[model samples]
Target: MEGFVQNTILITGGAGFIGSNLCEYFLGLGNKVVCLDNFSTGHQHNLDGFIENPNFKLIEGDIRNIDDCNLAVKGVDYVLHQAALGSVPRSINDPVTTNDVNVSGFLNMLVASRDEKVKRFVYAASSSTYGDSIGLPKVEDVIGKPLSPYAITKYVNELYAEIFSRTYGLETIGLRYFNVFGRRQDPKGAYAAVIPKFVMQLMKYESPVVNGDGNYSRDFTYIENVIQMNELAMKSQNEGAVNTIYNTAFGERNTLNDLIAYLKKYLSEFDSKIADVEIVYGENRIGDIPHSLASIDKAKNILGYNPKYSLQDGLKEAVSWYWDNLKEK
Candidate 1:
């Protein structure tokens, strides 16, 4: 990962979970990093660790504004476009705002990157683009009708990236992230991912709610794996790897019951009472697929991606972080 020469990298949504992590990692590699975020769903505290770093710069702005996009991309060598409104239910409740931010804002970033002549534009795509497919392990070439407004926006993003790559000769790579979880993922949101929310709940000895039967499953990727994929995308010189999408995941699936059991097992190490907490089941979520898995063979063969953590391994790390950071608060 350190083989590439130092270059300035611009990460939009740099105060969000994945964005902040990328900012820190790239800065650690001796690269100048510029963070552009609006603080809508992103928290400034996410940048607390490296806010004072000389190589790190923060610009508070929204992606919906073209000027903000242009300003963020100026003089940047690569753009890791992570700014977007991410939530299936939230999109359903308000498709207009979701589309405005995810689709329109994505276009703004693409244009800015193309105009600035960035070497590569790596972005956060979603597994929701596989919507309604029912395929066991989703591949990039195969996709179905998007199930929700959020899914539509993500699929549209892939299209826009492809067009920009073809029509304007802008290098682009889309990473379809699975359920990513780790340190600094906010657990106190209406649309928070299940792992953090459940960990926080179990920390307080409260019941963790399952939106459906505990059989529904997902491929939960860790933050470290995602960080590796982004770096590979930004630095890879392989021509075939450019202008395409890769599934960024550990390539394994676990049921909701398995997740809860693992969470309880890990958290119980810090608090024995967590093992006694029960899980509550309710109606299935409206836009959620029954199960999701990813095929990382493309990432492995092309970009040399070898994820180091499994679901259980990542949960242990995440649970410990929550215990150390959020338990006392």
Candidate 2:
């Protein structure tokens, strides 16, 4: 049954948090995996466990290089392009580099995959692409202006992907990830996501800083749900799923205050010390959307997407992983 999967699967940026999880999942299903990464933003430790897997191959290369893209795509049946410069503040600080990697690198991979005649090209899009579209439960067809460079780059990916499918006869699926978090997610770094950053701060007995009012909310999706979406996007039989973008989220929203309270409660059980830590509220970040939620009806209906983990359920699992692996360190 496992052999029915496309044997040769190429995952660009395969060592990053979500990419690494996808690599492990598809490989476990008995597919030969090729992981291409430059390690600029990804860690080597992400792929350390899979290095010895006979069916897995790692190509230490950059997506910015056309030859590297060509080399990685050779004989590959499916391409999961996940490499991108993420983070709104990082893009605000250095928009040029973000555009270079997210836009240019993305196009390079698209060109190479089309030329290689891959069966499917599924890439990571972002909820940021929704930008200033103030509407709750963001749908696919409508989008507002891109507020940040990172947003621009991601929106460009959908544009290029759509063009390739129409003009060059390629199959492309875009998954707009909303705040994905899980095991193997790096909690250290200035650019770390909210979950990891808060976990790290709580473990060190430091106050977790909440930007703006703490009432700001997000539709925080779990990493395992994203892995399911990617696999389903790459393997779906419905023609409607091709050349389309789907919001990959758990369809739930949580305010920063609610999230902080939840985190504090969970961490306190491990060390009784975190129970006393205070949360500091600061000025809101520029270019940050005040609230975000996703309408996952399209994905559920078209791709048979069923998210198994809700926020509380996923956080229970994730916080436990952090407790075991990160807290002691």
Candidate 3:
């Protein structure tokens, strides 16, 4: 990240979980960060820590608007497009809004980045892009038909990024994230991810629900590992690394049952009574897949990605954060 002091990076959705983390990291590295957010899905408190920092600036805008996208991309060295309506059920309920924000908004960013001639355009792809393939340990290539509206939107992102790269000659990198979780992940919404939701439920002594038989598995990735992928994608000097997608994951899989077990074990450290909390079983969710796993070989071999945190390592940190920062709320 050295020599990045001269860089002015625009992080769309800068108030959201993943984007806020990017803003914090870039600011710490002495980079100028312009955070463009609508606050529709992103929280304001995530920016409270760095709001007054000289290296930081916030633009209250949505990526769905080209004018807003233009303003944010102006005078930027790199664009990290993380703003999107995430969640399968949410998209299933309202595919129109999802397409507008994810697909249309992504196009806006690409056009703005191309017009501005930014060095690179990196984006958040999803493991759901491997939908219906029944492939174990998904690779960068060989994807299946999308299973949900959200999945289709994410797949379109990869396709657009590739076309934008070839046609406009803009450098683009797509990180196909597989079930990412960590600090700042919101647990209040109806579409909250399983990890954060379960963590909070356990903290309150509420019975966490395990959809189906609790045997479904995922390649749950940590936030720090995602940050590593973003940094490498932005700074890679390798010609082969540009304009391709990489699986940003821990390269391992664990079941939902295993997830709850870890949550109970870790939470009990702070409150012994939490060890007795029970989990409730529910019917399988609509459009839910059985398992998701990622093969990180392409990322490791191409982008030089080395994941430092295992599921256990990340869960320890995440559990502690929820306990200290969100416990009283």
Q: Flag regions of model 1 displaced more than 4 Å.
A: none
**lDDT ranking from best candidate downward:** 1, 3, 2
Question: What TM-score would every model get versus the actual structure?
Answer: 0.99, 0.98, 0.99
Candidate 1 local Cα displacement, residue 44, angstroms: 0.9
Local accuracy by lDDT, each model: 0.94, 0.91, 0.93
Clashing residue pairs in all predictions, respectively, total 0, 0, 0
For model 1, how does the per-residue alpha-carbon lDDT over 11-115 read when each residue is reduced to its tens digit?
999999999999999989899999999999999899999999999999999899999999999899999999999999999999999999999999999999999
Runs of candidate 3 exceeding 4 Å displacement: none
lDDT winner between candidates 1 and 3: 1
Model 3 C-alpha lDDT per residue in residues 256-319, reported as the tens digit of each score: 9999999999999999999999889999988788999999998898888999988999999999
Q: In candidate 2, what are the lDDT values of residues 1-329, reduced to their tens digit?
A: 23336489999999999889989988888899999999988889899888899999999999889999999999999999998888999999999999989999999999999999999999999999999999998998889999999999999999999999999999999999999989888887888999989999999999988999899999988888999899889889886889999999999999999888888888888889898998899999888998999999999999999999888888888999899988765
